[model samples]
Target: MSAILEVENLRVAYPSRQGPVEVVRGVSFALGRERLGIVGESGSGKSQTGRAILGLTAAGGRVTADRLHFDGIDLRGASPRIWRQLRGRRMSMVMQDPKFSLNPVMTIGRQIVEAGRRGGVSRRDAKARALEMLEAVQIRDPGRVFDAYPHELSGGMGQRAMIAMMLVGRPDLLIADEPTSALDVTVQLEVLGILDDLVRDRGMGLVFISHDLRLVSTFCDRVLVMYAGRVVEEIAAADLDRATHPYTRGLLNCLPRIDAEARPLPTLERDADWAR
Candidate 1:
């Protein structure tokens, strides 16, 4: 399969009073038209990695890499023009928190319609396409949601609307940061089905970032276990139990198993050496 994204020694840092603080340190991965999951704890830099991939790193953050290429296009110090040309049309990201990502002032429909328009969708068809995407994300009432403001919708509804917005353009590479985190189990499955179909049918390359290791194992083809701004292990999703890294093993052991009974749930023990 053709590689859609490439990264080598990718790093993201921010300026502080003392000096530069690196959040993502020398991370590297390549992506194809398949599902790849990155799993780690909250501060493990999982979300930062996804944001860096899409050139959405925070304003003060500095992103650098020996090689960061997307579909043969070099993304190092990519201009705003280049980002605008690629984002929403050929590439998109479903951010983890819709409350911060979505515009509070705009109606859900207008936001989604704008995304479609970015891909050159005609004004006449944009609304129809927007509504279709909302329904695709398992929203029960697309019509009502279309007119609702971001604050008017519940957390789950806002998340679905964000998903709808990102998918409106049918991007080739989708970097999803906990896309289904806010939804119920049933809706989570529906969203997963949509992503799976996009990978299988539309040939979309997906980078899934989540904290749920079990969910990643079932949905992704491969998994990257990150710890302290670095990937500690890379393994096939089906073979997670056989992971060699101690951090990965510790994480797995910490999970509660219905099959096995443990009076106290184990907590992850960290190793300072793992950061190196």
Candidate 2:
């Protein structure tokens, strides 16, 4: 399959009194129209890598790449105009926290409808699509939730609304950051089903960033294990157990097992060289 997103020697650094602090250190990968999961602990630069792809890096951060291309568009020097045209229409990101992704004052309906409109849907169609998305995310009383503001809903409810908003538009590439973290198992399965259908049927490329190792291993076609802003291992989802990297083996060993005798789970031993 052709690549939908490409990154080579991608680096993200922020200016600081101490000097430039590199958050993403020379990460590289390619994504096709399939699920690609990035798994790591907090502060592992998974979120920052996704943000850089969407041109949403924080202020004063510097992003440089030998090549960062998305469907033939070079993202290294892309202007605001280019981003405005591409984001939502061709690509969209579902942020981990709805509070950060959604407009607190705007009703969910308006936000989702706006996303649909940005994808070139008519106002009437946009409204319909927005409501359909709300229902798809397993929100009961879609109408009521649609009219509610971000702060009015619970964490999980608001997250579902945000997912609804992001999926309202037909994006070729989607970067989902811990999207199902706030959702229940049932709802998580439902949402994953939707994502699966999008990839299988609509041929949408997905970059699924999460801390859930089991979920990624099952859902993603391939997996990238990151540590301290760099990829420690890249392995097929099915072959995760065969991963040779010490970091990957350590992480797998740490997982709680049901069949095993009750005992304290082994913690990953840190290696300074893994971050270098």
TM-score of each: 0.98, 0.98
The number of clashing residue pairs in model 1 is 0
Clashes of 2: 0
lDDT of 1: 0.92
Give the per-residue lDDT digits (tens) of candidate 2, residues 107-131.
9899988989984579999999999
Q: Candidate 1 has which clashing residue pairs, if any?
A: none
lDDT of 2 at 254: 85
Poorest stretch of ten by lDDT in candidate 2: 259-268
Candidate 1 structure quality by residue, lDDT tens digits, 168-189: 8989999999999999999999
Worst 10 residues of 1 by lDDT: 262-271
